[model samples]
Target: MALPEDMLHFVWKYRLYCTQGLHTDSGKSVVVLETGIHNHDAGPDFVAARIRIDGTEWVGNVEIHVNSSDWNKHGHQYDRAYNNVVLHVVYEHDGVITRQDGTVPETLELKSLIPVHVLSRYEELMRGLHWIPCERLIRTVPTLNRSQWLSRLLIERFEHRVTAIFDLLTRQRGNWEETCYIWLARSFGFKVNAQAFEQLARSLPQVVLGKYKGRAMAIEALFFGQAGMLENVVFNDTYPRELQREYRYLRKLHGLSPMDVSAWKYMRTRPGNFPTLRIAQFAALCLRSTRLFSAIIDTEAVNALKNWFEDLPIASYWYEHYRFDGVARPHSVQLGKRSIDMLLINTIAGILFAYGKYIGNETYIYRAITLLENLKAEDNAIIRRFSALGVQAGQAAESQALLQMKTYYCDKRKCLDCGMGLQLIKKQ
Candidate 1:
């Protein structure tokens, strides 16, 4: 917020600088022919700009700063890319500035040119405290503007997910399948026992799972054993004892250590969301899925893919019990539409988006967004609060974007960088 250079960039981009009275530090009149397209990439701030300084048309680049000396502070004086700069724009002309070739570029001091009200409004937006800095004014922003900003937010969230998945991929030595399995397991656990599920997934290697994936019973044993849920339990049921026996054999064969059962939290959690059942469901999915990531990528429609997962059979034991000795769930233990949507949104669709980014394919990205757009908006505190503010999400796409905006932008008081803040600040 303290960087007047950002405000200067905005001013220069929009020609908000006082056109009627503009001059360089050397008392030469100035006129901007075109601000040029702002360079969002590394090189210059603005490229191919047409500016007239002292009756000379210089078509090149533009660089801005709070003071003239920042050209050297940022090592732009040593960079060849700055050699073509036509004008050095600054808020205060503290010192004379030069290009890499040692020629002084024409300097435009923006301090007296920008409207005071604009800067004041920007400062106020940056300093405010509320659910969001612009909560009071956000609803007033034009719909088209909000739509464009939400698209950017969605892309931001996509990039964040892609980066994280890449990190997981790297940790597994560039194994995409293992990363997908681990990520899927974490998503299956949701917010309650995500870490424990992830630990279980990591502890059991893909090779061992591949060896037993054809058998649902063995898959369940591997998952439950690594989760540390089958330790020292004397069960009267034949199936539970079979799982304990299978786990004992697999634990010895794989040379694997079980995770602490204490790590799996069940306090106040729903019976349907119990770790025991979730692992069983997860094992079922792994048993049926071959090339799970590719299948998700190739699957075009949401419901078709959803039905594929819904077809996974919940083991009979899960139907009879929520835990090793728990009472039976009266209802079938099949994953509901809500649970499926959560997995699709947080895992399957998310992986598609990440894979699309990794492979530089727009098809997968389009599929991911379409799936999200078709789903119901997630019913959560964030989505509800956004709805109360008159910024309702029509689908999961907007809700996901809103969640990102609230977490990474609003909560951090980054209103100065938000579109809503920009719109309100520039309002007359």
Candidate 2:
């Protein structure tokens, strides 16, 4: 019978030792340097580590798991990285694992030594809850310690995001400014219309806008034209006519083809979140700030950047019109404090990772992590759902892990490979 996974995680996480002598299936005595879950890129779930095989004590990492079969389940048996694995530890020994070089890796099974109470508590924690997981224990968890833990988790989370951004950078040939612009443009869609925004950016090159960067009218025309928002629009208004003229001038200046405005989608969005409004707001920010990317990178005072972002408002004409043909309604284009914070966090992470890659400064990477930890956890529906399950948002390592789970695993449905899920079944 399969044990509950959470219990397994708690046992692995806490490293509960069993009374049985640690030994490989070949009958060689194994000395364990660590009994906790082994960190592997891909392999068995866990490894029973040994310091020495025969008279020679091994001095490297080991992998572990709940079953010997997991080695094949995760395809570690065929991977060369597992060749250095000193010993394979599992909850049950059902099969053997061999390294790529044809050496049969030593194995150990750990079915005993874990206490029932520990598993019980872990299970209870995983079950449904009213307020916070371990609400009774929350007040007792030291504030300073909790804060430090949270900081660590937040930095880890930020590093995770930066890794993805770096991959995108690699794909884009390390054009940091262009990549940033793409991200900024995509983010403006606010989850509801990301693909559409990305399409708009791809259809209209940032190079075109760069040419007219000094003039706000020229910039606005470039934005509106590329967005396909200017098709068949006849307006007597001063701002509309001016934009129309500017668009025509830019098309002629760049020898650009007309965009397919019909490709844009606006079915599910409110007027405030329409692509046109977002693009206009983006244009306004670009107009007001000439050296936006440099300003972000060199900014020493976080508050200054916060102030600058907060002050940015959408163009005056956008406040009334979601589209050129739609009835006008008043709306402001200013970035919220939360939005600014996210941008700062992402920008800092990207710059730090980039700098680290260029200069070999691990300190920059650590500092980037520190900045993320200092901020509050991201607010979103998934986080709120977790929060409702007694997993209150706070400064704990677990909370940080929860946040990461919400952001990465839950959103992506990678639960089968998650640490949390592994822990959930360890006890049974």
- Candidate RMSDs in order: 3.3, 5.7
Report the Cα lDDT for residue 280, model 1.
Answer: 87
Off by over 4 Å in 1: 1-3, 36-48, 59-61, 67-85, 93-105, 173-175, 328-332
Question: Model 1's lDDT to the true fold?
Answer: 0.84
Model 2, 34-118: lDDT tens digits are 5535454454344544466666777555666678887788777678777877767667789876777888877766665566755
Q: After superposing candidate 2, which stretches have Cα over 4 Å from the reference?
A: 1-14, 20-48, 51-109, 118-149, 327-331, 345-378, 385-402, 409-428
Would you estimate the TM-scores of all the predictions? 0.86, 0.71
Query: Each prediction's Cα lDDT score?
Result: 0.84, 0.63
For candidate 2, the per-residue lDDT at 262 reads 71
Best candidate per lDDT, number?
Answer: 1
Best by TM-score: 1
Superposed by TM-score, candidate 2 places the C-alpha of residue 130 at a distance from the truth, in angstroms, of 10
Q: What's the TM for model 1?
A: 0.86
